[model samples]
Target chain A: MLALELGPVKGSAVLPTSSASGENAFRALFAAHYPFIWRQMRRLGVPESAVDDATQEVFIVAARRMSDIQPGAERSFLFGVARRVAADARRTRHARASAVSEPLGADTADEREDPEQALQGRRSQAMLHRVLDAMADDTREAFVLFELEELSRREIAELLGIPEGTAASRLRRAREEFMEIAGRMKATASRGAP
Target chain B: MKRLKDELPEESFEASLLAADAGGEPPEGPRRRALDAALRVVALGGGSALVAGKAAAAATAGAAATGGGGAAGATGAALAGWKILAVVAIVGGAAVGGAVAVTRTTDVAPSESATSSPSAPVPLARPEPAPPDTQSAAPPPMLAAPAPAPIHVDTPKVAVPSVPSTVPSSAPVFDLAGEVRAIDRARAALAGRDTGETLAALDDYDRRYPAGSLAREAAVLRVEALALRGDHAEAARRAQELLAASPEGPYRARLRKVIDGAAASSP
Candidate 1:
């Protein structure tokens, strides 16, 4: 079968020692940070239809710069890349309302059991993006790291390379803005603004 | 890092929205594509290292200020087709030599096809073009779609190439070389025009590295082998199935060629 013991990538003149290890590092980095990058793109105003492409753009940058990324700072480097990708996507793109493109064949029993809940989840997710999109990007980054990704305040500060006080204050401001915008959105939706 | 629900007294509108946000799972399809693209970059010996340096600096600078435009174009332009194929060929070459050395020492059977075949190895080399009706009339209903299906999806459950459980979701092992070797073995076999051997290499690849990073490459090679063996219809169907599943898949151009070639050659 495909399983074979992988020796060091030896005797490859085309692949320098640095790049071989870089490739290995790149794989591990991709595995670890892909979800974060994907979520960051979606939350940072990359429309749903474009999230995948955006995520690819982020990782492609990371892959190319694998050597420069310090061991502990991979997340920070990836976040930096993701921000630019999200920005680029938001700039050039038209708003395309995301369709429920769930893989029909792979629906788990849990998803099949509660279709309405699933739909509700989708709605809430869309709403959350709207509320987030209304916020400034810096505030949204702090909010995403803390609220959704569940990173500690110190970690968020480190990832964004800001003081803890700055990160916490940004998160606080983000929460206040979030509640305000979310309330307004609810009122508008209830009034049938669509 | 307490979730909003922990701080809030009750589940408010915003809290519910946050809850929904947490439930939103990132799709695996895109992740797989991203990985393939990244691996392609890595396999190219970090060809864009210089370009990425500039992009990274600009990205950081832009994040601090107003975001910059025009940074995305450089990396997109770097992903030319010949570079990718060169990476594949070089890595696959190294793998072929390595696999032979490892095969002698390892107890794993060299001929995976000698064991029970996963999908019956269709006698693709038959000279008589199997009547179209007869081919379609066969039992398993693979590729029932007028529209292409997703790459890792097996809707019919029977005919579709069994979507290996290891496609995505799990963190990939740091065996980029192993992935290259496994899929390259199949590529090498196909180079020899040994259809049976190519299919066997693929089966072995499927069995061993189900989650191997090069699963899509292996899938593409499988379609090519089928086509090479004169199983044009089967090749076309499988290519169509994979294309449907991953419209923007890595080997899209090659898969399109397989489908078009199959159509042109088939009765």
Candidate 2:
């Protein structure tokens, strides 16, 4: 069994489940993938307003399909769910396509890091989110998993359900697009500067 | 086309690639509430598509029954139910209009049909935070009548009276969920480090739900705000006091960290 640290949510307000072991497995699954799923939903362009619900929808879908999930396939499975959720979200509010993913709240966190670092981190995150949001869907998905998450091409291929060659091609396209968007972003930033 | 790829140093690009990921950080209060609400729904067997539908049958019926209560021909509940699994996913989040939605100007053209054209790239900055709307309950009435409401998941109120379908106007807005929204807004304020806004929001929260579920979260944030504003003595005192008050509190670690930080930073 993989040791997934559930952190604060291990026992926080656990709603009762029928099977003890099943609930344990579900919690383990939640522990393992909640953040990843949240991030993936944002990457796939679920607006922040709807992101919380979208993330929950993914998990609820997972809960309903819990039996179908293999042990190691959690993230990929969540990715698939995230994609569907994001698509629905975008369709519902195409205007929200330009929404910003808010920085994680610092209220509950350790503030050991300097406030300046935190601010810079937020800025970098904003830049990154913009660049990724501009890429075509397939390329963005592949690039996010492969480049940011550092999944192997074969792993990304498996996750995205494409041939490895297709995954590689998407990554290539994604990388070039990412750089182009990054360049444009930098140019845009420079232009906006007084 | 300026070869943006040419600008990326191999090693630097490798590092910066992951810089954007930031995947899997533990969620804070509002998000945690969302996750918890989802777990409650799923744990209650609302996870199945079939159950999600049955679970949302009332909301759907409420929408269909009412002519204008729902959006774009979609009632808030029905749209939420079918598209989002309803509050089974959005229970707590829905009440908090547009979970801090920040609209940024789009720099990239809608079409990525051609990559890397030398269109003068417009770098958009981060969106300014939403102006605090202390009294407004619904996200400033969406321009389009049918716009989907933000999902907010709260445990269903067993005691709240449900109006008949034909009379959808009688249904209450369920202000109980506002407590969560107040907490969420306070945190949003806290994130921007506006101590006054944070305090005022928390004060509003206190007035709204004196013995609310998120009191502890509010307290913790209050301490953080104090310290952030350089009231180290007050922050440390309050944190240590809160810690002593709830030695085994859920925020024990977080509280200790704040207390320690305040002490260390004291002049």
Clashing pairs in 1: A1-B204, A2-B204, B148-B244, B149-B244, B149-B245, B150-B245, B151-B245
Could you say which candidate leads in DockQ?
1
- Give Cα distance to truth, residue B73, candidate 2, Å: 46
Q: On residues B1-267, what C-alpha lDDT tens digit does candidate 1 reach at each position?
A: 566767875546666778777535578765775676565545443322222333343334323321222222233233222111111122222122121110011122212211111122221111123312232212111111001111111223322112322223231222333344455456556555577988998998788766544455677678878877888899889999877766644345556766877777867
True contacts kept of each: 0.24, 0.09
Model 2: docking quality category: incorrect
Candidate 2, residues A73-140, lDDT tens digits: the string is 44555667677667655554554323743223322134433322433455556556666766888888
Query: What DockQ does predicted model 2 obtain?
Result: 0.06
TM-score of each: 0.46, 0.42
DockQ for all models, in order?
Answer: 0.13, 0.06
| C-alpha lDDT (0 to 100) for residue B180 of candidate 1 | 41
